[model samples]
Target: MSLLNEKVISSASEQTQAVLSFVRAWLRGEETFEIHTSGSTGAPKRIWLTRSQMEASAQATAAALGLEVGMNALVCLPVQYIAGRMMLVRGLVLGLNLIVVEPSSDPLAALPADLSVDFVSFVPLQMKTLLDVALVADDDQLSSEARARALAYRRRLEAMRAILVGGGPISPGLEAQIRQIAAPAYHTYGMTETATHVALRRLNGPQASDRFVPLPGVETGVDERGCLHVRGTMTGGALLQTNDLVALQPDGSFIWVGRWDNVINSGGVKVHVEQVEATIETLAAEQPELGLARRRFFIAGLPDERLGQRVVLVVEGAPLAEDQEAQLLRALIRALPRHHAPRHIQYIDRFAETPTGKIERSSTLKLLE
Candidate 1:
C-alpha cells in the first residue's frame, strides 16, 4: 500500500470547521501544529507552525490571485504533505467547496462522480496518470461508455480553474501531451520548507514558459553558484536556500537547470545526470537501439578506490548482452565527455521509488550497498 493508505487523517472537529480555525485560535490564538516534513529530501522532522503564519501564507496566495471566498477546488493529493494540507486550509479559509477524496495512484479518477473540481494540485506522477487515464480508449474502435468516460474526464479537466503541479519534474514529452489536451497545468517550484510553491511556471497554452514567475511578495534571486533562493510570506521564518541550480532571467523570473547535488563528478569532470538522462531518453525516442529497457535508470558514483568515484549507469531491466551494453556506452561517449560517461553499466528489473512516486536515488544507491 502507498503511504496515503498507511496513514489516515481523521475528520476535523466543529472548532476546526473554519478554514483558518486552528490558525485563528492559535493567533487569538488557539493552537499550533507540529508540521512534519515529507522526508523525501532528507530526514523528516516536526516543525512548530503558528496559526498566524499559516493564515499569512494562505492570505498571501488569496491576495495574489484575488480569490474570493466560496470558489470550488479539489484536494486530491495526500494530506500529509504541506501542499495537500494547505489545500484544505485554503478551502476552509476561502470558503471553497473543496472536494476531498482518498489519495489514489490516479487522483483525478478517484474524485466523487457527482461533483466537479474547479482548482486542483498534483504531483508530476498524478498529472501523468491523469493524462493517461483520461484518454483511456476502450477496445473495439470506441465503445460508447469508454467514449463517455473519456469525454467526462476531459470536460472535468476543462472546467478546472487552475492546476498546480509539483513534487517532481514533468518530462518534456508529458508536458507536450498536457498542452495538446489543453490541461491548465502549472509546474510549481517549492517544497515543504516553503509552505508550498513560491513560484509557478505555466506548462500549457500560449502562456507556457519554462521560467518560473514569483508569486506575490516572493523575491527571486540567485546565489554566487546561481542557485535559487526564496524569501517571502510562506517562508515561515528562515530564508530557503535551495540546491536547485537555476538561471535568473532579467525579467525577474528563473529557469531551473538541475540540482547542484545531482551534478556527477567523475575524474574531475562535472556532469549533470538529468542532462545525460534527457539526451539518452531523446535518443531512445529517436533511435530505439539504445532504449532504456524500463522506466528507471541512474548515474551513480561507486567507490572506485582508485578514482574515488566512477560514473556508473544502473538501468532497471533484464540484463543486456555485453555487446549491447558496449554499444550504449560508445553512443554515450560520443554524446558526453569520457569522464562523464558511465564506467560500468548495471541492470535491474525495477527501481525503488518514493511514496510520492519520485525516483528515489538514495534508496536506489542503497541497493548496491
Candidate 2:
C-alpha cells in the first residue's frame, strides 16, 4: 500500500481532502503547481512553482531544522496558500508522516491527547492562541477539565522539535509568552514567492534574536531603496526583489524594518506604519492600563488637502469613551514623533483580513468610507 492509502489519510475529515489531493499530485510527479499570494498588502495573485523549486525549499528547511524521515509533521494551515502547501511538500519530499487537520485558530485542539508531532507551522494568531491556552495561569478561574486540556496541550507543544511561526508579525506580548514554552519556536520570514520562509528568527532561549538569519544556500541584499533582495536555490538562481525594507546587517542576516509601500508621507515627514504599530504595541506591553495594546489596530495614510496624506490609527473594536480616547492619544503622542502621531482614531466592528489571516489594511480602510 502506498503512503496515501495509510489509515491517517483514509480517516481524515473532508476538510483534509485538499491535503490528500496535493499529496496525490506530488506522488504522481506533477511538474508545476499554482500558488496564490496572501494579499495582505495588495491584491492576491497566482504564481506558478516548479516541483524542483519546492523540493529544494523543503530540503533547505529539513537541513536547517534537522528533520529526519518518519518524523510526524502536522499540516494545519490553509492548503491553497504557500505556507501550507510547502508544509505538504516538505512532508512528501522528506518522507515524513503527516498529520493533517483543518486550519483553525487552534490547530492542535483537534489532535488526540497522546499524539505527538515533531514539526509544525502556524500563523501568528494560531501561535498566540495555543500559547494562551497552554500557559493559562494556575490561579485563573477555569474548570478542572479546561485546565487539564491546557496541560495536555502544553505537553504536546513542548514535545515538538521545531515550531515555525509565520504568515504575520509576532507581537512583543506574544513573544514573551513563547519564551515560557520549552519548544524551540522560530519566527519565519518569507512569502509565496520564496516558497514559505527563507529566513527565521529565534523566538526564545539564549539564541533568541530580533534579526532573521537566512537558511543555508540563501543570500540576502538590499536595493538602493533599502528593500530586500533574495536569491539562492529557492529562487532558482534568479534574484527576487521585495518591497520590504530592512536594515541589512554586516553578516548575511538582516533585521526586517517595514514595507516600502506602507510608508506614510505625512506633512513631509516619512513615517513607517509598521514602526508606529510596533511602538504602540511596545507601549501597550509596558503600560497595560493604556488599553491600546489589547486591541487590533493598524496605521494608515488617508488623503489630506494640506499634508497630501494624513496619518490615522484604524482600530478594530468599539469606540473608546471621550476621556479614554484622549488618554490613548496622549500616550501615542508622547511616544511618537510629532508627525508620526495619528491625527485621528477610527473604529470598526471588525478589520478585514486576508484568507491567510493577515490584516487587509487596504480593504479595512475602505470600511471607513
Candidate 3:
C-alpha cells in the first residue's frame, strides 16, 4: 500500500464533505438528486431520483428490518453509491442516530469504545472483516487496553439489532462463519434502480433461505427471458426490469441466476456462468486436497471462430502447471455439464475493480492477452 499523504487525506476529506453536503441539501427540501449507475451490465449513466422515492424506500426498509426512530445506525459504505446513500436516507427519514465513518475493510476499527449502534450496513468485504474480528482478534496485535477495545468492538457488532450486507455475493465459507453469529445478518438483493434492497435473505439462522423473499408490498415476476421484474412503493409502483435471470417461485420468491448477458453459448449449448461458478465453489469446499479453496477463479467467455463463444476459466495467481490445469479441467467436466466446461485457462496477477469495488470482469479478462 502507498503512503497516505497530505493530498490524499485532503481528497478523502473533500469526498466526505460532499456526502454531508448531499444530506444537508436533501434535508433542506431538495426534491431531486442525480447519481450514476454501477454499469456492471452496460455503460454507466446518470439518473435522477425524487426525494419522495428515497423516503418511500427508507420507510419500506425500516419496516422490513423493524428499525425505529432514535436508534443508532452506522453508515460504512462509500457515500457515492446507492447502498451508502440509502443509509443516509434511512437516517433522515427515520431519525436514526447515524454514525458516519471512513469506509474501510473494518469501518468500526477506529471508533471509540463506548459506541453502541442499533443497526448497521456492510458489503461482503466489510462483513468478512467484522466476522474475522469477532471470530479471532488475537492479543498479539496489541496491548491489553487495545485488546479490550477490539473485544468491545466485537461485542458491539454481535449485539446489533439488525445487520445488512449488500453490493456483492457472500460466499459459502463466509455464510458458514455468519451462521455462528447471534445477531440477524441479511444478504440483500437490490440495485441502484430500486434505491436499495427489495428482498432479503437471512445469512444465518433457522429461517435462512436460498430464495430471496421480497419485502412487504413488493411484487415479483419474471419476463419472457426469465429476467426479474419488481413493483413496489420504493419504485413508485412502476415495474422495474432487471438484467438478472431468476427462477421465480409461485410464492413470490426467486433464485438468482447469472446476468442475462453473461450466458455463454458454445456450439449451440448455453451455459450459465453462475451455475458453473457455484459448482466449482462446492467442489472446492468438498475436496480440500484439490487446493482450489485458496485459489480465486471466475468463468467467462471469449469469441471463437468455430464455437461462436468458448468458455474460459480465468484464475488469479501464477500460471499453473499444464498437468494440473488438465486435471482441474477434467474435474470440472465431471462436476459441471459438458457444455459448461472451460475451453481455455487464463491466469492473472489480480482482478481489476470499478470505483465502487465490483470486479471488472470483462476488462480483467483482457489482461490475459
Candidate 4:
C-alpha cells in the first residue's frame, strides 16, 4: 500500500519501498528500534530508542513548529537516519501527508512543478545547493528548461511553511542568502540520541537568533566541563550528557561554542576549532574573492615539538596559491589571536564523510598521511 495516498500500488522504487516498510512497521506497533549515530565526533554506534521516545520527539516538534494534521511534510533525507525517520513518524503520528523522495544534493529538483510542502528538513549543504539553484542569475548561461526548473524550485521553496536545516553548521555566506528568501527557515541542533533536533534557531525573518531555544518539555543545562546536558520527555526523563561546549543563557536558550573533543591546545592556549572555522566563514562571506567559503574545510590540531599541539587549517581540494595563502593568513591573524591563527594550511582531494554527509574530521585528517 502506498503510504502517500493510502492507495495500494503494484510497484515501488527501492527508496519508496524503504519508507513504506518503516511506516508499516510503525503502524503495526513496533516498540523499540536501533539507530546509528552520525560519527561526526567518533565512530558511529547503534543506540536503541523506544517508540514512546520517538512519539514524544515528534509531538514536541509539531507543537514547537505549530505542525498540524493534514499538512504536507516532505521526507527527503535518508530514512535510515534519525532525522529522516522522525519525518515519517511525524506524518504517521500527526496525520500529515508524506511526500517521500530519495535523498540527493537537490531533493526539490525531483518534486513536481506545482508541488508545495508545508514542512521539510535539510542538511546545510542541501539548503545551500537549493539556494544556489533558486538564485541563479538570469545572465548566467543555462538552457530555457533549466531556468524554468529553477523558477519552479524557487516557488516551491517560497511556499513552504517551515524549513529545518540540520545535520551540520550553516556557513555565514549561506545564512546571508537564507535571509533573502521568504520561507521561514530554522537551524536545528540535536543528535541521534535525541531522535533529531531538540532545539531550533530561526535563520530568516525578524525572529532570527544565534541561540537555540529548546522545544516544549525539553530542559537544557551545562555540566562542570561547560558541555551541554539535555533532559526531557524525549530522553525518557534521563539526562543525556554531550561533549558539545556551550554557553547556557539565563533564559534557558543557549549558544553553541564547539565540540569539547575538537578543542586545540597550542602553546598552552586553548582555541575552539569551530570558532576559528566560524571566523574563516565570516571572512569568506565578507570577501568572496578569497574563495575559502566555496570549499569544504576544517581546523585541526597537530603534534608540535614546542607547542605540544599546533592549530592547522585543513581544506578539501587543491591548495591555495602562495599569495592567496599569505593573504588568508594575514586575515586570520588580524581576526584571531596570534596562537589561534593556523600555523599551516593543508589540502586533500576529498574529505571523508559519514553516511549522513557530515565531515569526518579525524578520518579526513588521517588522509593527509
| Top lDDT model | 2
Best by TM-score: 2
lDDT by residue (tens digit), candidate 1, 110-168: 55466666678887767777776566644356778777777777778777777888887
TM-score of each: 0.83, 0.95, 0.89, 0.94
Deviation from native of the Cα of residue 349 in model 1, angstroms: 4.3
Write the candidate numbers in order of decreasing TM-score: 2, 4, 3, 1
lDDT of 2 by residue, 152-214 (tens): 888889999999999888887889999998889999999888888999999998889989999
Ranking by lDDT: 2, 4, 3, 1
lDDT of each: 0.70, 0.87, 0.81, 0.86
For model 1, name the residue pairs that clash: 19-92, 19-93, 23-51, 25-29, 25-30, 26-29, 26-30, 26-31, 317-348
TM-score of 2: 0.95
Clash count for candidate 2 is 0
Candidate 4 on 60-139: residue-level lDDT in tens? Answer: 99998889888888888888888998998888888888888878888876766655688999988899899888877363
lDDT of 3 by residue, 268-338 (tens): 99999878887888887877655577878888988899999999888888877778777777788888877
Worst 10 residues of 2 by lDDT: 1-10
Instruction: Give residue 18's lDDT in candidate 4 (0 to 100).
Output: 71
Candidate 4 residue 162 C-alpha distance from true site, Å: 1.0
Alpha-carbon shift of residue 200 in model 4 (angstroms): 0.9
194 Cα displacement, candidate 2 (Å):
0.9
Which residue pairs in candidate 3 have backbone atoms (N, alpha carbon, C) closer than 3 angstroms, thus clashing? Answer: none
